[model samples]
Target chain A: MKITFPHLGNVYFAAKALFDELGIEYVVPPLSNKEALEIGTLYSPEEICLPFKIMIGNYIKSIENGADTIIITGSCGPCRFGEYCELQMNILKKLNKNVDFIVMDVPSDIGIKEIFNRVGKISSNSSKSKKEKIKALVKALKIINMIDEIEADAHYIAGYEKNSGDSKRLLNKCKRDAINSKSADEMINILSEYKRKINFIEIDKERKPLKIAIIGEIYTIIEPFSNLYIEDKLMDYGVSSKRTLSPSWWVKNTALSPLKINSLDIKKASKRYLSLCIGGHARECVGEAVIAKNEGFDGAIQIFPMGCMPEIVSKAILPTVSKDLNIPIMSLIVDEMTGEAGYITRIEAFIDLLERRRKSVLFRS
Target chain B: MYYLGVDVGSVSTDIVLLDKSLNVVEELYLKTKGRPIQVIQESFKILKSKYDDKQITASGVTGSGRNIASFLIGADAVKNEITAHAVAALNIDKEVSTIIEIGGQDSKIIILRDGIVIDFAMNTVCAAGTGSFLDRQAERLEIPIEEFGDYALRAKSTVRIAGRCAVFAESDMIHKQQLGYKQEDIIKGLCEALVRNYLNNVAKGKEIIQKVFFQGGVAANKGMKAAFENALGFEVCVPAHYNMMGAIGAAILASEAVKKDEGTKFRGFNIAQSNIIASSFECDGCPNRCEVIKLEENGIIIGCFGDRCGKHSGKIAV
Candidate 1:
């Protein structure tokens, strides 16, 4: 039996660990790529949204690589994520790919005992008694948490610092090694020591310097091509970026996301703006930018899916924010036609202009 | 140091010429109605009267209809509306945290953090809160589009009307009108209901914070603005070029792209006003029913793209 989770900035490490710990045979697809987008784009239907395309890409890549089964967290929600597993799995089958997907739709109203039950359904390990299964699940959960924390930090640090840092590098290596660890203590130890180093570091400026902040719809931000492997390309140009949203945020916000209710403030905001009846992320983006600038970051690169209304609002509001804060801003909208070259060139210039501005600020100060 | 940006969308084509620094030097708002090519030519003709094409250093294009605009005018940069809108927002106020934009066919929310887009959402299926919807309702009532907001503001009482979708919104507005509710009151109610439907459906699960600015053609409506303010419990700002923000954003992106590319793609002002041929064909590629649009200038295949798949994705020289 094998198991896998979707790749965020880093969940591959845990997949390796769970398979090894259970003594279960498994395989993970290579990191996502341009071809992944091409394949996914060809397969996915329009109107489903962007993240769906990328996730479909990841699954297609994995199943095509001979994986027998896939595991995805299940949810029921207002965010439309609850339906992803069923829809993506069906799409894969429609594409005539054969693979078993163990979709564990975690009941929002339930607890982690369900996790053990879901685990038990697959493993003969159920013979080991309930306590044993609980212990294993708990341990697995801890490792998952550690991997998530590391990934979250890596993304955040990458946001302020530059491309692949000591933290991100060490986290990747440590995550791999920890995944291969023989015991929970081993994974914990590696995770612990790694956390010890994530905080004490800074980017090597003389090495190279292009920095950007990636903030937008969760669909485009994490996916490689939905927005193009923008982070990778930026790194190719020696640019480091801070991407604020991640699947980790999805996991983190899982509990709080639904409870975020419509309030008087939303109504008031609607009146204040376009009396725009719906689509709300524009304001959150503004708050996020102020927060980034306060953190002493250089500039920001914004990305969003085409025809995404909430994001359009953010795009409209950001220019003023850039001016008042003295930060350079680049907003990229991704539809099918957003050629990578055109997007990347914009990034290079934005970075160039920002660097010049930073240098001048330094000289003046 | 004048720079220009053009936003050619499904319903309208807007243009903005900015200084090198992206300040608006000239602006054009023309109804695409149905003829994008003709309107663009007319826009150029108008701009030519005021500012010589020589003074324009760069230009950019954005929106759903931008492909033809870019191909026709040799745009230095071609960007989606999201990027253009975000850039325009940042250029105006670096502290702006949110942007709310509603056009004829759609509405969007873009969230910015320190001039970066941190979050965004868009409403595509519904037209209840969009400009075209309002335009239809305005016409049905025999009220001028420009006076819709003022009429809405005069309402002392609002009769609740359904605005969940275009069909419902229209019928409900008419029903209320038939019931003899004051025109002003019905208009106010229509704006409020549309605002409510938008917040309930489009902004459903997102966190909408502060420092919001309203843009797009629909923003010209004062009653809608009031409704938005009432809904969010906050003041919403409308930029000077609210109607042309998308175009301005395109212009900003164009200027930045030109600086990066060392040249402009704009085919020069004279050619922007030339003849163009456009058509579409169905691709039997798979069962997705993708329709690929083909555009040509004279006889040259300028560009092609659409919703379906690779059927006509490969351009065949005819």
Candidate 2:
């Protein structure tokens, strides 16, 4: 069976490594673009969120490229995202596109046996032995962790690099080279090599660059295309940025969440503001802003799609957070019509304000 | 020694010259009419007749067309309209607690306390309460845009017009006219509807404290200002330079930037005579197909942007 999945930032790299090692045929749909969004919008319900439309577009593109089976994770939720799989399947069926779906829902909801059965469908396609399959899974996890580490390091070091653009160049080159690697092992090796190079890249110890934290809805924050590559822009401006969410982080959080042991610090930090999960990542967004302020970030930027219900709550609460903490926070709600010039101007102005606040002692203690 | 600020928006291009002491030396407001470059050049020509280019220490650009403005004339500081509006309001009154700014294409609410912007929200993918909507209604009514506000203020009674969307509002206005409502009442109804739209959509949940300053091109409409005052049950003050606040704020930012950097990237006034061209093409490097834009001066590429991957932004020759 040929399998396909939607793009979510660096998760595609891990999927490539996993399928390749398992010796199963899979198709990685093209990275989301305007064409995909247009196609998705044409077929999707009018009120559906941006990520759903983008995912539907990815599925259609993958189906055209010979993918007959679609694998997606499932969420039972108070948010609209939980309803996407059913709606997407109906739309695709109505369009007469033949495809099978494998939804990996949580064991608590679908039961452990059902998960095993679903996962077994894919593993059964592989000719590898049980021990070998486990090894492949471990290797895939290692690859994702390594890549996330390399990316985090590169982003933080971009601000202090002795040679301007050194970190950005290396980070971009690393992604390009990994995508071009002929084998899963080669991709892991390339990522590790880049990780080593980034760690050793020359950085100025005396330079103090403005640092910011990116916090928001998971899909918009992690996906570069969705938020207009904000982290990349921050890197270009020689500003250090930090984000706690990544593919690897999501995996760990999801796995340990049922045990009530996941992201304990985030839960503790968010207690005063939002003690209960109100659906989606609203709590995480608020917690991250508070954490960022404590960590001495000059400011935080909260980005989410337009009309996102959960994020709208966070957006309202963030002003109180900003006022109480005495930190500046900017909320950018983006849609297809978001003008690039206005978005960039806001970011530049925020950076300028941060710089001025640091230099002008009157504004600070 | 003066700092120049230019706000190139969809409907209007505003320019402000500020002396070293932050006093407005000159202000020019011109219709953009879909030709930002020409309007900006026209304003510069008028300014050139009064002051020398060498006397301008630094310049900044703001508003929707800021990127194009920065490319055409080297800007030392470029900011967003929200920040610019807040700065200008604070400069005018340090006690100002809230700023309601509605421009040509967008409207925003800036919440400030102790002269710092704490929270803000701009209309999302909607332009129901902006100047463009008012301009369109004015055109349909066969009334001059400047006199539209006067007609609203002269109304004896009000009519309700749906203001959720521009199309709905227009059809509702036509329905009111069909019902034989007076022109003055309908205009006043539009103003009230627009204000209600702004309060519900843009300033939905914020606590709009006292000392609110209304600034933007739309602030010229005394009717809208009065509608805001009526809805909020508090006095609303419009700045003297209401339409030019963005430019004034940009000039203030430019002054501060020049002091900090001790340099200006201002291209001489001769830039109006230079042959500069801008164009865009989709890059096929990846699936994103980012539409990369290039600015050419004398047939040589000076700036390339809009690529999310920076594949083209990095390739530009400095």
lDDT of 2: 0.86
Model 2 ranges off by over 4 Å: A206-208, A356-365, B48-51, B204-207, B260-263, B315-318
Residue-pair clashes per prediction, in order, are: 80, 0
| Each model's fraction of native contacts | 0.00, 0.33
Q: Model 1 chain B: which ten-residue window has the lowest total lDDT?
A: B309-318
Best prediction by TM-score: 2
Q: Model 2, residue B49: what's the lDDT?
A: 76
**What is the C-alpha lDDT profile of model 1 across B48-164, one tens digit per residue?**
767776777788887776766777787887766766787898889998888888887768777677766655556633457888988888888899999999998999998898888
Look at candidate 2 and tell me the lDDT of residue A207.
83
RMSD of 1: 11.7
